[model samples]
Target: MSDTQGKDGLAAATGRFDAALARLDQSLVELTNRVQRIKRIEVDTQRLVQERARLATELDKTSARAKRLDDSAHDVSRRLVVAMETVRAVLAKTE
Candidate 1:
């Protein structure tokens, strides 16, 4: 090949190589950014899971407390009815 033709071919090859390298670098940057975003999402998912467990535990405790309160209310109601019945009997005897 002629010297001029060879130099021109070499320059063209170098330009193509440089363009390919730039594209590779851009791809790497985009990949890195995507990986970072995925890591953040994983961290957030773990945090939300912990929060859900804590909320579930709290809900269980609240439900148990509510059940106890309901039982106590029933007990108080039964006692009040018995007291009223005794009062009525005493008032009837006097009448």
Candidate 2:
């Protein structure tokens, strides 16, 4: 090949190499961004799982308290009925 032709071929090859390098850099940037997004989603999913567990514990405690309250109310109602009967018996004896 002539000197000019050799120089021209080398320049063309260098241009192609530079273009390929630029495309590789752009792909790397995109891949990095996608990985970061996935990490953020994972963190968010873990947070939601923890929150659900906490809420379930809270609901269990509240249900236990309500059951105790219901039992106490039933006991009070029974006592009230006994007292009313006693009052009625005493009034009948007096009459």
Off by over 4 Å in 1: none
Model 1 steric clash total:
0
Clashing pairs in 2: none
Which residue pairs show backbone clashes in model 1? none
lDDT of 2 by residue, 13-60 (tens): 999999999999999999999999999999999999999999999999
Please tell me which predicted candidate would have the highest lDDT against the true structure: 1
TM-score of each: 0.93, 0.80
Q: Which stretches of candidate 2 lie over 4 Å from their true place?
A: none
What does the lDDT read for residue 85 in candidate 2? 99
lDDT of each: 1.00, 0.99
Error of 2 at 85 (Å): 2.1
lDDT of 2: 0.99
How many pairs of residues collide in each model? 0, 0
